[model samples]
Target: DRLKEFPCRIEYLSRLKSASQQREICEALKAGKIDIVIGTHALLRDSVRFKDLGLLIVDEEQKFGVSAKEKLKALSRQVDTLTLTATPIPRTLQFSLMGARDMSIIRTPPPNRYPISTMVSVFDEQLVAHAIREELARGGQVFFVHNEVNKLPQLHAMLLRNLPTVRCAVAHGQMRPSEIEEVMLDFMAGDYDVLLCTSIVESGLDIPNANTIIINNGHRFGLSDLHQLRGRVGRTNRKAYCYIFTPPLDVLTPEARRRVAAIEEFSDLGSGIQISMQDLDIRGAGNLLGAEQSGFIVDLGMETYQKILDDAIRELKYGEFSELYGDELSNEGEWVRAQDCQVETDLDVALPESFVRSATDRIAIYREIDLLQDESALNQFEKSLEDRFGHLPERVKSLLTIPPMRWKAASVGVEKLQLKGGRLSLHFMSPGDSPYYGSQTFAKVQGQLSRYAHACRVRQMEDHLRVDVDGVQTVGEAMTFLDYLSNG
Candidate 1:
């Protein structure tokens, strides 16, 4: 019924195919006879040509290298490429953030799905038997990932001795592809209780009956790799478990400890994005513009790098991309305006612990506030807060005023704004004499300073121009004065 509804020819091509079969498939693809074709990296072979391929969907993209993807793009540069992964790589985030790609987030999970229950523990034979037996008792199978090929046999022997009632099979990349496929087929057919293999099982295997995976020395795997392996299970509505065994924290390196903890902590549905973000945070932002997607991001320091990047992106939007994306660039939200600009105020600006008790919630709220672009959005946010957390405290109300003040200060080319001891100061660009002086906003600011008389004063600092004003007692007062200074 499904095939009839679609009404297109479909074929599978892989290394398992004979020469003639592959040739036939390639010919069909080249002649536009095949409507849908699914296969391994075998599809990427140059022999497999396509006639005006309109769409290319690559799943588990983190497993593919950059050059391979580039070659795929070379086949059809105009092809609408969709790369799918549970854990997005750092490179993917970089491109999406740099305006090179569009990103759509699918936070909703499929119906009848269950989040995997994940854990990190020191390796012990007893724990292994318990996890395996638990799955078996529930009429499910298990995947035991022992990455070291040589050690796999010893572990398999030990498992057999400990859990003699369980039927187990060994599969690894060192074996012939045919043998591995047969073993996988048997495991899926309920011929084996556990498939003890290398991480090769991370891909091209979908058996909903396998609801648990045990990884030996999971600390050795990369963050994304661990995610993919855990994802091998939990395919059905049945609950799943991923036991990541690692060396004890006392013996493991700090980096390995973090990697282990991260996978264990993110077991909820849609945790792939969170794991990727944690990976980025643990590994810095990486070399954004280069193929080396991680490491050495600490060179310029994140704040400095962000400032330079913001300036560069703005310059690109106005200089190079202006001709092509003028409308879009001009329509970008409040983030672009306030981004490169830093706001420094002496006022006590914190989500008082009394308001939001949990430190984590307070931090998340602070981050959300920082992203809000303008006053209207912030006013709406204030209403939501009041609705959720009773009346807004005086400090909470004061905290809401910073966003608009920062946006206004940025528009006038003030890199920093400081309100200290009832005195407000707007610090202009470093090396004061820049194109900012030629902008209409700066002209309006200058007109306001002169018109306001004793309320405002301008001082020439060594690297920047500082505009000082009086009568700013609270954040609200500071925001009011800033609005008047920017426009009045």
Candidate 2:
């Protein structure tokens, strides 16, 4: 209505429509008559196509199926796409981190918004009645979500019988759209004190007058669903309350119990992201690339599956996509460096026998040096060595430097460190497409690359960053250069 030129048509795609109605919408879409279409799963049908499609935006993307997502992805490959989701599933988040897709997160909450007060317990009539009376006294409405339609009447009757003066209404997916609209409109107008319904009110209903939500058997709902269901209230500045009633703790399944705990624990203003991750953990992630549905982490196990995936990706980039990736797929070193950061050097990195005298004592000191973890420990070891064997020799000092170099390299994501051939080389982790490239560590390394600009040479090795620097002929020189490059 606000836009002057492009006509927007919001089609009701929830239920099946007549063939003529579908054809009319489809024709309008194909002919570029409709500029915007706010629809449901029906819009993903084969019959729907847009003329001169330039942008695609997907909201609540986690609710869609794998095949539907694939279709959206295909559209995205051709046009600009912006996916919006309050709660993203674990697999989707992982793929974004792996650089399969770009992602942005909005962590800030709305101004003057209050966190919902969530509590969980077994069903108790007295408690429910008290909660309703409290909200009503404040001139606010209440939402009693009993998801089962058949059991809704019994609960409605109980509410009516107990609180005869309180006006109440029920709405669910089974009800006609017009009927649901009438009931919702009446409730919004304050015609009713309570709206008892199913999960239909999870999205798009923004009635600030409703500040309290009571979810019966909330354990049956997934973590994301529970978050959205509880989200029906607390739309305004008024403080909101969420009561989640479930069966006895012993009776509920392990996953159900975990879900309830997570919902109750994370009732903050911006807890949707955490809730989705909890959902993923409670109910394992599905196959990401394939069309398989959720909860496949049980098969082959997550660790083993990830190992296979890493190997396959590395192999593809090295063999099949070698020419396509060019310098980015230079070698398989990226995969190897992901595990350990080692500094290999041609110079002898050990204490001199003349300095230590006893070979037994030298070996003992070597073992102790290997056990050093931090700079503090290294300092203490250096002091002990100095006290035992007069002043420290250059070789001993260089040997001591290697430990901190490894620590610095590991912190900045360097997997393999080499100090041979009078030049030092650092190999970063794989895949080059990983989100780590854009991280602060990578940025810091880039800034220091300009310090030794003349002596340093960089390469794009299999989607990973590799840097080689000359003029570092000694072990001490190598450690100082590494500290400057990684820590600077």
Candidate 3:
């Protein structure tokens, strides 16, 4: 329809065509006569050339191989390139999230779209027959996806025998390209009531009338693959159904179970982002920076690796931390390191299972607390906990108090705070070179310590100021003492 308005020459190249035909298309593209050329990875070959290519578009970018994508990227260096995919690869998604590339998401589904009713169950012949019959009665089609091509014929036979009146066809990658295309075209024309096929229908095939999909051994598929296959049925307005037939739950591996569960959990509209994140957790972030960095991530753990990356990014964007700390950052691991506020205590500072029962939710809250860098963030975290989990328990409240205590201690050049053996020890950072040195605040702290000489012992070491708690015995008393020192 769009071609009628423009005076343009277009050529189509594919592996299914003869070499002579492909050569002709290439010649037309090189001569600038072809305004648009559409093909598979064949267009990425060295023989292909364009006279003045102004735009490049790759659909289902996640489906391309790394080498093919690299070649496409090289071609798009100075041209306007647009990549589209329902499920983006982790590396590409990370690039977009990190602001390395512009991204736009389409969350609104087309009119009349409904969430697919997904079911994960063991393979039962009666269940499969019932599902196919129901869709057939509604004048709709069905997609029976079996991953093994060799077993497709047996499954097709079984389906036909179960439903003698239903017309069933088979399609798979092992078949000839012409045969696959014919089977797909027939299915689209409603010639076949059910198309028993392999994963070839995983991409670029949209059948609105085929609203029922039954995947044999669905546990063998990845999360993204399962999601994309389920997507084939839910593209239209009518309600869709997806039956993931697998072995019993106990027989599946832990990772396989997680993948299936994640797919089933995120079946809402615009759940692609959540699905991608779940995929990342199931399949460790694959070579986001490079293959070499993956080893560092595996060795140091993801949380510690992310901390290092965050520090490096901060250093690059906002100069070195030493610039802010007056060379104290460079002296890290020497006298006293910058931003290292150690908290050693014997108090119960864990979230009790009775309060937050779910381990996943507790870990999420712990991560949020670990990320708090200021008082405002701490306040917000407290408010969120209250809103979600009701009034905080005593232990949880104590857990919340620790971050601000560490922040205050760091602000006043206190390197370590130990509250153990019925005594409290405060070790301040090196004098004269510290930010708190030579300031009125330091003098005020000294005077305050002197006033409590009977309750506290203050002594100046070569590199640090040591304060020993002589009167504080309980955690409450120690907290009160530390609060006084912090406030003054």
Tell me the spans in candidate 1 whose CA falls farther than 4 Å from its real position. Answer: 1-5, 284-289, 298-304, 315-338, 348-404, 429-440, 459-465
> Compared with the true structure, what per-residue lDDT tens digits does model 3 show for residues 199-276?
989987878899999998999997778989999998888999999988998988887898889888899987877887
> In terms of TM-score, which candidate is stronger, 1 or 2?
1
The residue-by-residue lDDT of candidate 1 on 1-488, one tens digit each, is: 23656778888898788889999999999999999998888898878888878988988888777677778778668888888888777777656766678877788888999999998888999999999989999999999998999998899899989999889999999998799889999999999999999999987688999999999999889999999999899999999999989888989887788788889888888888888876765666666655666654544544455567777776676666768875665453422223446777778877888889998889889878977877778888999888988898878877887787787777667788888888888888665545456556667777888888676888889977788888778777877777786675
- Alpha-carbon local distance difference test for all models: 0.81, 0.81, 0.79
Arrange candidates, best TM-score first: 1, 3, 2
Best-to-worst lDDT order? 1, 2, 3
Predicted structure 1, TM vs. truth: 0.86
Candidate number of the best TM-score: 1
| Range of the 10 consecutive residues with the lowest summed lDDT in candidate 1 | 331-340
Model 3 per-residue lDDT at 244 = 96
Error of 1 at 177 (Å): 1.3
Per residue, candidate 2 scores C-alpha lDDT tens digits across 1-488 of 34545455555444456678878888988998877776788888888888988988888877887878888877677799888887777678656746788877787888999999999989999999999999999999999998899999999999988899999999999998789989999999999999999998988788999999999989888787888888889999999999999999999887778888999999988888788767665555567766654564544654455567766786776667767876664443353234436778988778888898898988789878866888999998889888877898878887888888787677777878899888989888767765456566677778898777888898988667889988878766867876786675
